[model samples]
Target: SFRRSNVSPRFLHSNSTSHTWPFGAIAMLIDNAYDPDVSAKQFWIDKTVVKDQDCLTFMDNGYGLDLRTMHKMLSFGFSDKTTVKGVQPIGIYGNGFKSGSMRLGKDAIVFSKSKSTSCVGMLSQTYLEKIGAEQIIVPIVCFDQTKSDKHILDLMQ
Candidate 1:
């Protein structure tokens, strides 16, 4: 956790956050977050999925790449609010933005069109690497919501 007062140089040495890892390390993090045993992709695809009309537009360009730039975006309404109903705080790690950076690639362009006008979380691995960070991001772009069920079983892996 970076304190508001002291930045980097000092923050790097702090105990709260001290683990400078390479880009390859991110792959393991993502795999650990999600499971390979009991899969849930099919359930999510069949249940929560409605139509392709649920993606909200977003510039997955890492939501901009710097602290000032990202903060500016949030201040300008890039981090929209929406409903979050997952498990009862079980596997929920409470930080999707960070997770997205690794899975989406260092420089990804994400575009979503969802049902809600205010539901978004954009992350860029390229920018995160510059700042020394990463996450298990999964920005799923629905391809014809109608193609759920067995179609997704093959896509889950």
Candidate 2:
């Protein structure tokens, strides 16, 4: 059975675009992560469990979750919502993060600003095992004001 859930934008992962899409922008963010000049920009690499596939996974941590959205959802959003559970197109509702992680990694790590985050959070191989899901979403870096302001982290107070 299939049901709809209104879980919006945990990450800013855009829906796939055929044309007029910025492959350039995606490349730039990846580039900036590795750039020597950008100190606020950090690179988290999971070198051990490569699986050697030609795929790159990027997660946006804190860009979309501003105060207004949080408050709106907090007020009236909770009362009228229904999240389903099953293996569907995205494969496993509501449990995507856990399901996906279980299917991917034996170990995981979450490279986040939060020091309390687990290594298992970022590494997908182990994550899949833990969550017992076919897919999972991990929020990686925060594209905050530093990236957009053009000031640079090394120069800030």
Candidate 3:
């Protein structure tokens, strides 16, 4: 069984306001990738035009997140990270992804691929508002290469 709670979409913008400086928000995201659990040695940030809209992309060769982890990342107030190999993680509040991402834009799409799975998740204030949603909603899909589910395949494409 799954339990549900209601969080207004407007919270995204209000929460992001804590980031007075955009650079600080970007640093929070970079710290997440550099954290011990992800241990990313390389990270790339770029800006490109998509459908005539300027967009930013961040990529890292880190240990990618699974569905469960992705869910936790999108949710508020959940952090299970601990010290690893004498290295400490910088994101302790578990609010970085939301605050940082929403500070940069109204929408964000995350693509992560672990050793055996690929996942996609989206956090979008624009989407919520357009749909007249009262509560925040995040849609996530995971694809396991070993399985051949048509629905999953469609989502992957």
User: Which candidate wins on TM-score?
Assistant: 3
Q: TM-scores, in order shown?
A: 0.25, 0.24, 0.90
Better of 2 and 3 by TM-score: 3
Task: Compare candidates 1 and 2 on lDDT and give the better one.
Answer: 2
TM-score of 2: 0.24
lDDT, candidate 3, residue 65? 88
| Candidate 1, residue 146: how far the Cα is off, in Å | 23
Worst 10 residues of 1 by lDDT: 38-47
lDDT of 3 by residue, 58-141 (tens): 999999988888888888988888999999999988999899999999899999987678889999998889999898878888
Q: What is the lDDT of residue 130 in candidate 2?
A: 55
Q: Write the per-residue lDDT of candidate 1 for residues 98-155, one digit (tens) a residue.
A: 3333332334333333232112234444444556543223233233334434132111
lDDT of each: 0.30, 0.31, 0.88
The collision pairs in model 3 are: none
Off by over 4 Å in 1: 1-90, 100-104, 116-121, 127-157
Whose lDDT is greatest here? 3
- Candidate 3: where are CA atoms >4 Å away? 1-5, 148-157
